[model samples]
Target chain A: MDQDQKKETAIGSLFAQWTKSQADLWEDMIRMQFGMSDASEKSRKNPLHQTQKAYESGSKILGALISTLSEPENLESALKGMDSLPEFMMHITQQAYEGYLEFQKKIVEIAAKIGQHTEAYKFEGIDQNIFKVWRDIYEKEFRQYLNVPQLGLNRFHQERIARLIDTLNIFQASLNEFIYMFYIPIEKSGAVMQEKIEQLAEKGEIHDNFKEYYNMWIKTLEGHYMTLLKSPEYAEVMNNTINALVQYREAKQEVLYDILKEFPIPTNKDMDELYNDLYILKKKVSDLSRKLEESRGV
Target chain B: MSQTNIAVNLILKKLAETTGKAKIKVRKASEVLLSPLDTELSKTPYEVVYKEDRVGLKYYKPSEVKHKYPLLIVYALINRETMLDLQPGRSVVQTFLDSGLEVYMVDWGYPTRKDKYVTIDDHVNGYMDNIVDFIRKKHGLPQINLMGICMGGAFCVMYSALHPEKIKNLVTTVTPTNFDTDKGLLHVWMKYTDAFLMGESYGNMPGDLMNLGFLLLNPARLILDKYVGFFENMDDKDFVENFIRMEKWIFDSPDVPAATFHQFVTDCYRKNLLIQNKLELNGRRVDLKNITMPLLNFYGQYDHLVPPEACELLTKAVGSKDTEDICLKTGHIGIYVSSKCQREFGPKIIKWLKEREGEPKTDKSPETSRTPSGSKIRRETVKYVSPKKIIGKESKPASPDLKKAK
Candidate 1:
């Protein structure tokens, strides 16, 4: 969507929210006029003593909404919170790709700046792939850093977790693509609504009935999401994304268990094994007990 | 100047009016925020009949038992059975009891690391069978009414097929039976998923992760619009409380047992083996032809998770002569919670069950107290799939050598 259009949608949504309060007020008036509502029942449902609890809950919901609705730099940034979950997945995609692009830009700018003072470089073995060398060095350093005891993971298990995280990054990246695909409708409707809002704003048009357009925008987004949800590709992507995440988790845990094996601690693996044995034994005992009781005519 | 002046006046007036309303809203919302919020869910009372590791059987003793066979509500391992009795008036369990039916539900509690190896056989053949036997012994009946929802519905279909004699009548709401159809995204996705890798990763399917997957399925509405709407409607104590309750349920998903998840995705979703008579539990095959009891299959017309294509084929696939189906004009979850659906869902289900149970149709009034809006339901089609023809289909495939000789 165009910048103006995006702004319109954001403003329109705010106005729309305000419009809902008006509607609620209208309802309250209608109820008062009719004297149809039961104050006793309402109070019974929301006793005076419950005001504090309601405030806390309402504040929580409001706080969450305020945070979520805060204007983002772009649609993608809006969706991607600062250093959120997708980042901690150990593999980076959005940030990494953007980071690489920015890095290239910075390097070129630095080179250009340096050229003004002196020759940019000696161009010694310039024919070699420089990118690979840098990438390899970075990986090796990152791996080493991961092995540091202070890094949270033991030295032996860091490599394994690193590998898992990297593998998981590929899966998460693909999953992210699918998730972003699911957002296309939201973006589309938002754009359309934004465009209309912008046009109206430019024309200084009086949108007396903003509620209808607001509802349309929500419904349009919902309809699009629902439609996209049924697509075979969406399902495939959604399914594989989870599997990928699970694979990474399993690898990480396996590494954890391996490291835990040398120590005197009780590991997840040991617990799982014990649970399995106990479950099977429990079933056997239950079945035998039932059988014995049946035989004894109990 | 005239047009611009008029527009400016209108805009100013509207802005002032909106600001005043906004103040009221903040005040009302603050009042609600400060007030005690009872966002309680699953308020219906029930006692534990049996417990097995992460699984338990809950019995909601009826005020007066009117049915010969007790009803067993089997829920999917992924979500809690609390959804059936989500709220007072909206609860399926409540509706059943109010209609004078014995209600019992299987609660597949949160699975731990130890539960990673529990397979489909352990669930349907082992636990479900044992539960059925226990209920039968308690009630002193030969059979019971079996109902399932979503994955639980699939389990019911499998259980009914494997042990037709144990179920007097079957009710499946939004159950995905025929997985081969490209009706839903879950089917398509599961086809390519590495079930073994998933099972190996976490002992049980992480409930939170599964919940995340569900959120991703409808990101636009679920992640954004829904949350915004909740805040917008925060002034309404009822709406806010209900929203919180729903949030609690949506997030209360249980991590599925690894073995069960593995088999479900691979055997059912990937291979579409159950409908094809190729699915095996423990050592025996789950033949859909064996589900010969009276069946009432419910499906939402617009259920994205389990579409009509996923549910409608069960009658054709099964060997039930007295099968009925109700396709409600709602989504998967709406049938249980939507105000429009509350009237049709519980009432229709109860009415159908009552008719099959030899009770008069007019025993209870229709649940049409509220003006029925935003909903439509297709009448049940009692289709017949002769058991002999369906079940008697030879299990043996044609021999290669014999074919060559011929």
Candidate 2:
């Protein structure tokens, strides 16, 4: 055969191999979807079942393209199959928009609940309830997106970015909770001071000395803060906040390492290695010097 | 007059008075704030005699050296040693100097990333040991008076145990030897702290973060009330100057080396190993029973950082029979800075040291000597002895001028 004919033959075989692999993957996916449906009636009613159905439809289109490519004579059929690509993408986009809308609805519902609680002056429950609501929403609805499996050559980098984002969110949430806890003392102290002032007013003994009132309020605030700080709940929240911060910083450092790798700037990993070596060398020298001193009886 | 009218009048009168006072205060405050005030810390002149990496030795020589052995004061790495010499009147360094006693202090300079691997062992056995040896050589004495403040006290305790012959008199102020207590918020929090993770993450524990933790311990006082006090006393130049000085000192914190911090929090705070004498440095166990020298321990009664519970047990745990623990009625910083404590704390320490201050070594015949306890001791002239020889010895004070501390 001529060189051109040989090259064309080689390309045809490569395309056939690619088609076979894609066909096998689609077939396995279909079989898994059917198996899942058959295994549990409950799973068939799940949100993931809808995703499987969408995947099944996309798989049919892909199968058509694969067959047309393998047959080589069905070029027109492949072009016809390609026409469904935009529709398939639109279907996926619509699902995503609906999911986003659902998320927004949940957030608005929680926000409305918070507004109602605040309007009623239920200060005691407001902080706790708000923190719970936000934390629950993030963990249950949004955290999974950050934890989703990534793919391709940039999979690790993408995963690091996702983790960094996830950790940042977690850190902010914990920090907000901590700040709210800190504010509770102020709120409680204010209520207590107000009660004291009201009692003084009732007795017709309200003092003109503002310093005394300030002292009273400050002391009450301090007492409340002391109680709050000493509590196990406060300790737990503080620990969580600190841990989240550390995790976020670590994630950020990892991402920075990737970015810095392209630049001439030495990363923390490089410096740490150098530090370790220097530490060892210094320690060895110190030990030897000490040994020498001892041997010399100096 | 009607009740409403009387109330209105009263309110108006109070408001008028407050406004007048505030105007005067503001005018005075502005003048005071703008004035050049001496808020400088460590005002007592001292020369840097030795330096090792980031650490330095500050020597504050007296007009006349009254004591035979010079004192080596090791302040905590958490804060600057300038706290001792905050001001002329309140300066602990000055107090020691005025007593005609030679004073030497360790300035543990700021730790960078390179110092992350510097452990407690490096501190107690390495820097401290070298400093002690240098002093011993300088003075031609076998041992010197060793004093430690706060975390530095912990290091001193470890050093004294490891090299008993190198320390004549051991004094620990606001030192926490026993960490198995919930009296202090620090102890409680440290118990739950992931020290290893913190060390690994930050390389060195940042000082600002520690200060933040301290502020959180008493937010109403440290954060709010402190600034409130400053604002209220803004008109008083002395108060403002003193406040600024204190502010400078408090915030002038150095990062704790990561490995040292990790080991301290783990071995001392988490495990409570120091009191148990289970703590080890440089592969050698720090046995409290090895500290045979006279020990004077002081702790503040209201010290939230290092409570009496964290310090009082040290004297009882030590091998020294002449151990005294004085619980001063003050907070952590107040024990040194408070005017009331200035009278009691410095005088008491000087008196205690004087009582235990042995005679100077001379080339004359060996004479009989008396200890602070009024016991007669036979003098013996001897050459320099190795530290290892005196490590585990249970020797008592044979002579006041003896080279061996025991």
Candidate 3:
């Protein structure tokens, strides 16, 4: 092989040798930083299912709440069993936050290394973008968290209380998965950043072809992704987050529908009723038309 | 151009490729962008042979037909079946057609609120059954080859298990039959999912919500990197058109029927009933032992969504003696779309089906095919390592054949 061809092979081999041990270490670091690595099977069984019954009419919901709240510090006591905002906002989030910082360090290192090798495209400090994504998600989630203090037990209205607890549960779940959530964009950005390397490879920045460069990135990214995805923590957090959101939307929708019913105008429910009636009528008409046509041999 | 000038130009052209080529391509991009592009899918000359509600059976007549039995493609409800016929040169349907394989794809059309009552029984036994019967009657044959993709593959497995008499050969690509494994996060999340509540609340599972969850599975790549990569290659007309086609297929997901989703999660995913011979549909048990047809189960080596662990167990769990599991060197969608995968995937199925064709059709009951031959899985292809061995070792991560991933 020629000198340039040899160089490309060397670069390709550099990627092929990336060991599973390295992937495990990186995955562990990311999970540990987020407190996801510490989540046990016991922690996954958070009493989230019991909240489903809280979306009933105010009377039933209030009756259930009253029955539960008869015990001293019951709701607060249950909330205590789970990690509060302070635990994450103060202590548990530090390692995860630092993990993002470490991720930025790696991004910088990878980006600079590729930049030095190619001139087809300039990778202008991609680490900054990763950090920006991290900061933005954190800020947005914090704003969502700030809405929680207003939903205190002072509001005894059953619907409002239901929405409050559900919303808090979601907010708490978000806090728990904050690091991993932020890391998803980062995990994907690795490929985006690889475009710079690809441009370089095309422009003779690197002797190897763009396809080789892309495969290297895929191998690297897939390892980190597969490791995280296979974890019990990732599964638990994903399950909790989606379940919490589904419940929250259900509760909010019910409460909103009630308020909308108070108004004389059409709400989602009124429109849904009208639509359902229309659909059934349409189906009946179509079926009858089909029968008529078939009878006439059309 | 003189020899000296030519020599200088050769060196300069190489240098120009570094930066000059991109500028020239970008300048040409605007001209192509203004004109209408043909990004049409399911365009391989298919006619709707039969229609049942929103569901339609699209038949694509091939240029040449050498096979005895017709092949039916059962695609997942989550996304449109147009991925099979995505583009002119890159189409899976076209590939099969070029190889003299008659193709029929099931278009599980968009579900509405009215479809909330549709269950697995309604799909596997109802719509799919009708379509299979239609194909059989159309061909004047008793049985036809059945091929299903993703969720459709799961349905094919169910259908084959339930009615082994109707299928000559079964090919399930990127299908998840053994949902008990925790390797795939979808299985885990579904296990914990309150499907009953979600079903009642939404009527039908929202397509947008499903897309959001899918995007989260690989946020960095799916949400950001994909589009950015498209932007990077926007100058290439073919690349841009292909990107647009893929984008259309990806976002064109249909809402799943609520009852179907609930049963799928509860029975198949949470309870792990199907593989264990406990799932009941239409008052009859969906015994896996009934999947006794000549089986070719294909999965993407790098499929994170339906990991090999989720798919690999099916070859053994089923009672098929002629079962072959081929792990292609690509991810889920890439199994059909990727250039490298296209070379091996379609041809392999064509060959596997042809070998098992025109055999004396024996219509056997579920109990007759329950003979276990778990070790009969053929590993003749490139590097067939057991998914359990790789996924079983705690520290070692699953490594797909990455050289061919793109």
Candidate 4:
């Protein structure tokens, strides 16, 4: 295989593995939140048995999608297969809105239950007229405010969250298509491959193609590897990717911090922290593999 | 400067020579027909009629007057007062004279850097006081019949209010009283205007700049259309002269004394304190309600500069039970020189005054008494008759631009 194809295969495999690891960690947290585990025999007859069963099924589906990104050929095929994802996401977003309406109905039911159990006592501001006004306002408009119309981001706080997650899946599928559509063709064609590699390197990113190409080229011939190394592009790609990985980690941490602040779903936080630790391990392994591939002196 | 003078002299001489060609006997016929053509061309003969130190007022004696007491014409400090007596027949002063009224006008004179310190108090209390006193002394009259134009009208109104007993009758023409109005852009813009920066930058606001601002309020007509029309009608000498004369008067602006400008803009128009009868000059409160004298208040219906809303406010503010507000179908300047004003406005003012004064021939009153601040308490009484020709020596040509743009 050509250096470019090899690099593509390497990147595709690494990205898929990282995604699968993240998915696995999330699945583990979901099981833990529901007080279930592979070792628990009572899970079979538990009252919330469906929740544990659903988590397992969802994790498996997500894992399969992530694995498809691991191989160069599979990644290319997936990009072609998901060309209409952006349009699909739009349809999915509409369905999520309907789900949110149902979720709002459930919230009203819960609010009524809470009001039945809670006692109210007020002396200073208990105007009967103001109560009517507030009741009218609540029925008319205030409930709709919880949905962020500006971002068109679907809600996910209640059972409606499943529909929102489905929309996000489509969005991510489109983003993956965007990555493959650009990265695959450039890697397949060796003409000006170094230039494309350097460009991507300047962005501090290691695309699948560059990683595979460098590994394969180093293994083939010592003289060729030395010649390629003499070109500053090789060193530049490595430096840029390292910088990108650092930036990516920092950005991910920020996103986690923001999510924690807003949602504070402890189970999700625990899963996120677990994923981060695994990501560090995965990055260390990838770096060791790259060093071993280089030192072989192809 | 000498060349400008010579050019002006040539034009005036040419105009006179042309007048001589006609059978013009009376000053009225000569001035009416000739004055219109004097400022026709850009190169026409027009000059500053008078320029002197702090004292350039053209004082008149009772012996020189055709009527009993002198007619004190108070024009706004913003413009040259000579517009009232622009030329013989077209002149308002000439009309008063023809009707047997003695005329004496106060000239504030051109203010310079040294005069920038002068205030509203100085002009109303000091300069005006001295002019009235000089007339009273020269003619031995206790008070004079006072008529103020525009800002000069406001000054005269205040003067009459402080010393109502001295003014036999008061006539204010196109005088702004209620400055709070949307009819004129100037009043509204002035509420937030910073004259301090303007004065600091330009020393004194240039007359052209002030004029331009006024013209801009209606640019399509005042600034552009009028000038274009003037150029188009240049072939007609009469049209050309009137155009240049009007341009001259409009552009001949006096640098307003800084202090006076500050007070006028801040205290009067911006605050609308004058009409409220809450304004004070020096230490004395100017209460418009103090004016109980017979008043003839005139306004121009088409005066965009001073809307009737502003000019008519005087009727409501005054203490005079006999206040008459006449709305003329004319613009600001037309109220003074329009044919309508000549035939009706002038006659009406004289009749009103005559009625209030009780027919000058029937009643003989004593010298006007003075108030605490030396302001005359009542109109002075005297009897002086007209001669066929008590010729006023021709005034030197007022600078071509006496009425600066604003």
Candidate 5:
């Protein structure tokens, strides 16, 4: 009934409530995951069900520690319970790591199949699925880390840095794709030229003049390039590459602006504003001079 | 001998010859590259007569001026006007001068950061109008003959529409006024280009980037075959000089003013406003019907940048009764630089302008000049006369007989 005892009892009750809520939340998650009303016999055999059980046991151990700590005489027992915490966390982490490895293995298998299909010439363009996979993986897994809600006085600066890094990666990927598209024409032209030369050789029509071959190869390359460049696919990729480059440049300029704020040299933003103002002022003067000239009939 | 043995022997023989030729070519190329070569461009003697910010006006007065009105030429902002006077034998400016025509060309100097805000209106109405008026005042005339090249041609068209009284005859060469056609890769790509984003991000549309785009239009030829051809002909000194001169001109690009680039792409390329006469510059619509001057529109048949489709429609779109569209048998730069076109292109324009010279300015009233004035808009009538026919068996100077009926 004394103040210290009353405080210990209140703390004990709070810890007990927390432990019960945590257990209830785990049970609800397991049930929802299994689409079951309760943790039935069938559900208990599930790996997630085992995970729920482990969570419950961990919470129970924490509850025991809280109760033991509340009673000053059982402080040793509470410490012993705290010693088991690391082991419990290891078990949960191990399970999650195994799950991630399995997922990655399946993705790798799918990616390998796509690679095979691309080599088999199933698709017309540079294998975009590989790039798509990389982008999807980054977007789904790593992008969230950079996009995590930043806090503190330097949060804006931090976010800009993050954006710069993100845009740079995207721009580089798009550039790679664009370069690959360009390489396609050269590759096709070489292959086609080789085939043509072989056919000519077989027909015993091979010319001694190497210039003929050079001309044919170049013309073929130009034709291939024309077809590729005019395609909607190439246009789309070019636009995407340009957009990525622009975004990267803008993001980089923003970070540069922050860095250059302390320097004596003017940044593009500063110069742009000044240029815009000067442009307007000069235009007005030019217009006025023209009007004046017209009025004078000169 | 067996066929395989014969083929192997032939290959070996060809390889030996190629190696021998390459060695000689490399030595000759090194000598040519190291020697004091006359590879300079714009060799025609001219004086810078007027200056306005980054723009300059070059006056190339013929020894004897034949026409009553001086011909003012406006070159595109994309590249330096040095292209017109690339070399002694291949210079368009020289051809005009030889024909006793006084030439005034606009040298749009390299734009810096300050020039990023220069718009189409500034180019067409501001600088172009000022230059026209300056020429008119200097010559003591109400109007002067105006000619524009590439994007400059588009500017001339706009100027002629806005101020018809100042242009006695308007000539557009390799201009892309009707950008709606997808016959050229530039038109197709420009439709997808984010011009505003490009302008805002880079401040000015970088000349180097534009060159890269141009190279991509035909990488096989521009990037690959061009170098291969150079190496093959490295032993020829004349070829080397001409090639080097052209290389200098091709790469000597100037950054386009950002605002002008944006408006051109949006109004002309994407919206197809210039051809539709819906393009507005400085609150005034560039109504094609306002162009009442004798219009001579010339385009290259093989021009990949500005196809004949893009250039041929301007003559029909204009209000001028005396409009002619000449589709030269060449590419964009070829129309000006190619030896074959040097005979056909310049002479044809001179003849057309000569035919309309000294005529009274057509009244600008809507009812007066817009109607059929008996002068027909000639289309596909001028054939590419053989160089042998024009330059006769006696090796006479080549002159296109514009009066000859096909």
Candidate 6:
């Protein structure tokens, strides 16, 4: 490659690397924030009280799953040793609740930013004589809040969470009953049967009957989940999330440009005049853009 | 340059003569033509001061309309019903009131989310029922003289037919009934529309949308040429005022309830249910044969929205032997507000009603003699077509057999 081409390739690689690192950083941040580093800390309740109960329940199930994964051979041993349904239920509910809690935090953060910034920026050329256009948008969003069964989440989000919780609860109860009636009795009598059950648990695959019940619960939950995902509320959140990421990248790029473009930070007096002139320039440019658009029937 | 140009200029010259007479006549009648007492518009006759869902009627009773029997003006729901009583010298309400007729107009109010569920049945059966009941209670009368314009005329026809005993005499101007005619673009569009989807997507079909559809029907005239001509003559105050008033009325539209919109486009327009006598209002069959009262059906020879062919069917629909179809040489709105209408058409309505009611001694004997013929009414098959078709579209299908024809 020529010198210029080589430099371009290097810059492109650096950008790709930076983006990959950013994604990793986010995942790391989430894990640390949730205290997933250690077993004891992983099971602890989140301090965000609204999500605390849900988080605690989810983390506990996640803790059990992690324990099983670390020592797969012992899962068979554990299953054989297991006596009651309550323990299984406790784990399932915990994991489901934690996933929902994570979803909640992400949703609220995005929704709040959209709610604030949408007001800060006005649409460029709507006729002001048409009264209550802005007010109607505000009213619809306000009504959205009321329509939600719970505050902070959209209607579809709340419905999905409810379905998840419901399915987990039923699965937990039913599985416990199944284990108590069948598995415990077999495990108590024969070492060979206990070993077989332990082997199944270690593989992370239970008997066909257990799998059927679990799959049914998942299927029900998924039906509600897919519906929620397809909803306008979910689309808004997903769009806003992507937009936030893009805007953050743009702001970062602007910071780099500012560092490159300027000699140094300007004095306060200079900054005042600079901002004023910038604003005037922005207004003039906006007017010019509008005139162009109007001419083109845009 | 064009045939229309020569005809319009000649009409305008005749309009100027009528204007001169009107100015002189209005000056002499100013004292007697003062605003009506104890009416909502007494303070400001032009503005909408009162609106009510509770009372189930929007009474645009201009202080100017002061005849003996209050003229109940019904306008098409597709447009605001305010054109008849708009303002000052150009108003139909003012002309009627000046001629001594009390005016009560119906305003189909703006529909909201709650009103989105409203159907043709709710409007025709419920609200109309309440309005008639209220009027009856207020006036202590068994029947009221009714005037329906455009779709409102169609609604009045439905109401009158369903409850003939309640309508003393029926007057429908520019009302369309026979939709089978492929004469108007609007009829063609309505015939082919997917009303179900339109109703489902937009809970209330917007009047603005409907207006846009209408404006598209004759884009060269309505959208471009008319506006260009209007701007050219913008300096003339009288022309501008009348133009503005007409524009205001044309643009001011109410969103129709989804169910009503669906039924109107599908049942009436698409299926041609009303004219076929298969239309049902609130589970009750609407048979035009039930209408036996005095009927005066009028249509403009030049109305594009409701072609003359579309509107002339009313005279034959009713079992009323006393029906009169008055075909005028004007468009839809012109039949009410034009200077020609005042001098030529408005007087016709007053004269007909007076004859029907036997109010004038000279016309009383003829009307009295005609009362016996009403008893000879028969419920039978009849071919009904608006006189608009016979005069204009020569290729239109033969009129069905009249009850008396057989």
Highest-scoring model, lDDT: 2
Q: List the candidate 2 regions with Cα displacement exceeding 4 Å.
A: A1-127, B1-6, B359-406
The DockQ value obtained for model 2 is 0.22
Mark the regions of model 3 whose C-alpha exceeds 4 Å error after superposition: A1-180, A183-233, A259-298, B1-25, B63-65, B192-200, B359-406
Model 1 residue B193 lDDT?
54
Q: Mark the regions of model 4 whose C-alpha exceeds 4 Å error after superposition.
A: A1-298, B1-37, B40-55, B59-66, B360-406
Q: Name the better of 2 and 3 by lDDT.
A: 2
Better of 2 and 5 by DockQ: 5
lDDT of 1 by residue, B1-406 (tens): 3232126667578778978988999899999988999877788888998987667999997788777777899987766777777777678788888877888899877777877877888888788988999899898888999999888899999899899998999999999888887656556556755644655676667778677667655555566656666666778887777777777777787788888887888888878898888899877888888988888789976676787888877877788777666777656776776666677788777777778878677766433221132122354332543422221111001100000000
Write one digit per residue (lDDT tens) for candidate 3, span B1-406: 2122123455456666756766876787786777788777667787889998899988888877877899999998888888777777668888888868888889889898777767798789778887988899889999999998988998999899999999999999999888888766677667765644566568788887787777656543555446556556676677667666766777787889887888888888888887788889878898888888888888977676787888888888788777877766556776887666677678777766766884453333111122255424433345655653332221111111111110
Candidate 6 per-residue C-alpha lDDT over B67-169 given as tens digits, one digit per residue, 9 for 90 to 100: 4455566667776655665555446665665566655677777875445556676666656765776677667878888998888888998988888888888
**What is each model's TM-score for chain A?**
0.44, 0.62, 0.35, 0.25, 0.61, 0.19
Q: What's model 2's lDDT at A72?
A: 48
| Candidate 6 lDDT by residue in tens digits, A1-298 | 7999898667656655664565555545545665543345544443554254455566556555554434535544655567456776676566556645655665565556542322111222212211222223323333343345765646555554444443343333333332232222122223333444566556654443433433333333323332332334333333333333333333343344445456675533354456457645654675587689789985
Second chain TM-score, each model? 0.86, 0.86, 0.83, 0.74, 0.88, 0.75
Chain B alone, candidate 3, TM-score of 0.83
Q: Is candidate 3 or candidate 6 better by TM-score?
A: 3
DockQ value for model 5: 0.28
Clashing pairs in 5: none
Docking class of 6: incorrect
Q: Name the TM-score of candidate 6.
A: 0.47
Q: After superposition, how far is residue A66 of candidate 1 from its true place, in Å?
A: 75
User: Which tens-of-lDDT digit does each residue in A1-298 have in candidate 3?
Assistant: 8999898667545533443334445545544544432345654454432232233233354445554544434644766767576776665367556656766776676577653433211222323344344444544543344345444564435646556565655545554554544465344547555675556545555532344555456444544555555555555555555666676776677677667777888866666677668656765675587689789985
lDDT of 2 by residue, A246-294 (tens): 8988999999999999999998889988998998998899999989988
Error of 5 at A65 (Å): 16
lDDT of 5 by residue, A45-159 (tens): 8887787677667756765655555554465466679889998788756755665675577667767765242221112555565455566656665566678888999999999
Pairs in clash, predicted candidate 3: A33-A96, A188-B220, A188-B221
The candidate 4 chain A region of ten consecutive residues with least summed lDDT is A118-127
Candidate 2, residues B268-346: lDDT per residue as tens digits? Answer: 9999999899998978999999989998788866677787899877877888887776766556776787776788778
Residue A281 lDDT (model 2): 94
